[model samples]
Target: MKTFCGILWEGVRKELQMSFSAFFRLLLGALKSFLNAETLQCQVFTSDEENGQLESRFISLVSNDDHKFTCNKKILSSKSDVFKTLFAGSENDQCVRFQEIEKNLIKIDDVDGETLREILRYVYFDVVDQNIMDPNPNLPFKCLLAAEKYMLDQKFKDSCQDFLVLSVDDENAFDYFRLAENLNAEQLKLSVGDYISQYLTHKRDVLP
Candidate 1:
């Protein structure tokens, strides 16, 4: 002979216990999923880092003269946008392996061996030798062309422009002005124009 209130209390208690049990189970399942996802992500990252260390860190560059040069991939890519683009692979691609690097050699058909050597020297040591510069007056122009092609640092191009400006004279003023215009060198072009104007003024002043 249980009362109606007693029967109702029993039903409510049972329902509350069942609800709590279900909630705890759902929480546990979600936590397990989160932990498993974290572990998988960590494993993938570790694999990529280890594989990168084992791969080739250097790349080969071939000049027009058939001379091959080996450069550190990280160093070259950091300095030049062209190298960075060349080194970067597709989004779905994996890390570059040693065999793949060996098979792919970057070619610079417009630059010769000697010019390439100088470029490499500057890339490595950040210093251009005086002997090299003095002996070859045209080296700056050649380097400027290579710098433009490879998208080297602006400081290097400016240095080349400065050297060319110092070498400008009456005989080569027009030629240098044309080269400056072709290369989009504003400072060099203005300097050459000024020099040509002065030369013309001096000649007019001394006219017979």
Candidate 2:
């Protein structure tokens, strides 16, 4: 009976030891995973900080109305050939420096404050807000002109052209046709011609 009890006790002890050993191994693996995740997160954060520093370099612009705007230099240069040339000039000029708090001051004499603001919004966010344009029918035209002057992407000009095409009516068709001609927008000119032809046909049909 004593020998049997000793054997049973010894077996239980071994089982408990194995259980504890397995539990500790699992715990250690979990701890290692947690530490590795933390390290990866830290590395990502550091990389983001570095990129943020590069993106924060800015330049100052003054509109014809004297409204001032601060813009990201990299974004402006990357988006527009005109801005790229302007900033490239700054490299040779002593007046503009990336490290300077005053930044490179550019004067845009053709574009007014409000129009320039919209242009910058498109430059940064790639959007033209229609809510603002709806109340002022001339806003899209102004933005279109600015887009051309600044040498913005053709996609942006297309957005403005689309808005203008939608806003066309009997009252503004002639003016819009002239605008399309000046911009050399074949699509808009064609659309205006079609609208005018249909309108004149309908008017003739209803006449006494």
Candidate 3:
């Protein structure tokens, strides 16, 4: 009887120890991932020009101005699904984007250099200041596109959502609504609808 009790206790103790160890490991893994995602939360904004370019799995981007620059491939792939899929097929081979370049140089099409630089900065750092946005209202639209393309905005939660809603107005409210639909942002869609409804109602009341 004494021997059986001792063995039973030992087994229970071992099982509890294993469970605790596994739980601790899982907790650490989750914390690491959350920290990585939230690294730039509320940090002071910086531009690509001020901090210089980040170096991580570098890729070449040729802007519309015919200028060339290097960007961090890991950061781009992590932030943008478009980039990830672009590079996905070349797992066993060199990056497909680079191979397409005549001199083993890759270039992102359509987007200009300045715009790409701003997007990259947003990826590594955070949002550009309100001052930057004031002059170029379309800035947020581009950022929203990149965020949606990479499924990144989902990770940041309300930050992107609030920014989109705040930036909406009579001129761009519909644009935000369309973007919200594309991004599956149900909350923003509802918010955009509310804004449009109010605007139309106000306009109708003031008509001659």
Candidate 4:
């Protein structure tokens, strides 16, 4: 009787093991079938018009590598709220870095020099809006040179001073002075330095 009971228990255990294996195999097969059906359903249901619309929307929202003017205009116009999404309330170094990246998006086509300049001008205005002065002397110095050139071409003496004063060091300041002198903007040059100096003096006097 004991031998028979032991054999019966072994048989029941083997049956359960086989049943579990079969159950798992069936479950796996079902899952695979479901995934395959889903993929096929997606492919079969996508109409040509829907797919074309999707492609058009994607092209409009993202930068067009072939015609960069489209992308540039979109950025400048604040179209599709992409930039707003990216830089909502972001400032300082983060904003500066974003502006730099935006500058890189300007196209280098044969007749796009004005577009490039406009992008640079946008960057300049961004810096001004954030009251950012380059911590690195080199960057601000380069900016001063650019500002001087821009002012000479545009004849914007006041704007030139704004960039010149940002150069920070005496040498850069003198470089701005020379450029101003060459442009015959002596009065504007003197006024710009004096204004910045007075502002600095006031700021220092207020500091504890």
Candidate 5:
């Protein structure tokens, strides 16, 4: 009877030891998973903060750079011609209309940096080629077409967004305009137009 009791006590001790080992292993695994999750979240947040800072710098460049240029050729090459034709360059003239339009465009904030560069490039080339403003009424549509071609020639996201901002208003704008234009499509072009229109018109739920 004494031998049986001793053997029973030994078996109980071994079982307790195994149970404790298993519990400890599970606890360690849970701790590891928690640490890994926390680390991943921290990395993502850091990346997002960095991106926000970069975007702020880009916006400052556009707003403070005094971009004395426009997307129209006539405006760049013959600022006088545009002024004369549109406003007669008179003190009490239509030049104010252009100025107002410019002021509004300038007030636009949050345009992507790459998009601004692409738009600047397009405007620069248009000035060189003397094709900024089309003689025809369909010129805005043509601008969209030109933007598509430009985006295709150069693979950049910034240019595409600039083009979209400038041309999305026209009724003739294409459905897959970004794809056709060779522009970078970070998001759907239609969605972009919807957002812009909403801001401009103060109408929400108007996105297609």
Candidate 6:
């Protein structure tokens, strides 16, 4: 009788183990099916029209000529002190009353379309080719104005200064010096003076 009772208990425990094993298998199968369904339901938004959906999170900048640009608020605020301060009061902010204010956009009256485009691209990706300084001679000045307007980082301002210095010639050297003085760019002012002095020395040496 003891042997039979022991055998019965063993059968009960085996059944319980098998039941739990089946239950867990079913649960895992259901979870995988749900995940597959969710994956199938998700859609990719890679096109230009799909970018408009980000308006709720992005800041809308409207140019004077009615050109519109959208930028990531977090990126701008992180990179620019001007944007950081503007967005700081957002919690109790009366100026930006609408949480999703596509209608109430930022007005960019001073910066031209092309300069603003380059600035926005730089803000997004932190890249601008130095080669552009030669073909577009006035680009540095435009960039300076945009940088000052945005109150951007020292790196960006310095990059613009470096470009101006590299592109400066006797014809544009005095103009750059004046621009440096106006913008308080000491690096560029010194660069201008050095470039002119070097040019004068070169001319004197080359004289027959």
- Compose the digit string of candidate 6's lDDT tens values, residues 20-48: 99999999999886543322233356886
What TM-score does candidate 4 get on C-alpha atoms?
A: 0.28
TM-score per model over all chains? 0.64, 0.64, 0.55, 0.28, 0.21, 0.62
Q: Arrange candidates by TM-score, highest first: which order?
A: 2, 1, 6, 3, 4, 5
lDDT of 4: 0.44
**Candidate 2 collision pairs:** none
Tens digit of lDDT per residue, candidate 4, span 1-208? Answer: 5698899999999999999999999999999865543221223326889765433222111112333332222233342232433335445342232322242342222223332333344432332322323343333334334444332233333444455555535435555556666666665478556755776788799999
lDDT preference between candidates 4 and 5, better one: 4
137-184, model 5: which lDDT tens digit per residue?
333334344444332223223333454445454453444444543544
lDDT of 2: 0.76
On TM-score, the candidate that comes out on top is: 2
Weakest lDDT window of 10 consecutive positions for candidate 2: 36-45
lDDT of each: 0.74, 0.76, 0.65, 0.44, 0.42, 0.73
Query: Model 5, clash count?
Result: 4
Tens-place lDDT digits, model 2, residues 39-145 = 21222335777756643455678888889887777678777777787667645343232223354566777788888888888887778887756678788889888
Span of 10 residues, lowest total lDDT, candidate 1: 92-101
Candidate 1 structure quality by residue, lDDT tens digits, 1-208: 8899999999999999999999999999998866543221222335777656523565677888879887776667766777776677633222221123245566677888888888877776676655556777888888888888787877677777788888887888898889889988887888888999999999999999
lDDT of 3 by residue, 1-208 (tens): 5698899999999999999999999999998876544343332327855334322235577765666766556666777666776656545332333334653246655556655666666667755544436677566566656456445645443455666787788998888888888877787899999999999999999999
Off by over 4 Å in 3: 1-56, 88-99, 126-128, 150-161, 204-208
What is the model-wide C-alpha lDDT for candidate 1? 0.74
Query: C-alpha displacement of 107 in model 3, angstroms?
Result: 1.9
Quick one: how many clashes does candidate 6 have? 0
CA deviation > 4 Å runs, candidate 5? 1-131, 136-152, 155-164, 170-184, 187-208
Model 4 misplaced stretches (Cα beyond 4 Å): 1-131, 138-141, 147-160, 166-173, 183-188, 192-208
User: Candidate 6: which stretches are off by over 4 Å?
Assistant: 1-56, 90-104, 199-208
Error of 1 at 52 (Å): 9.1
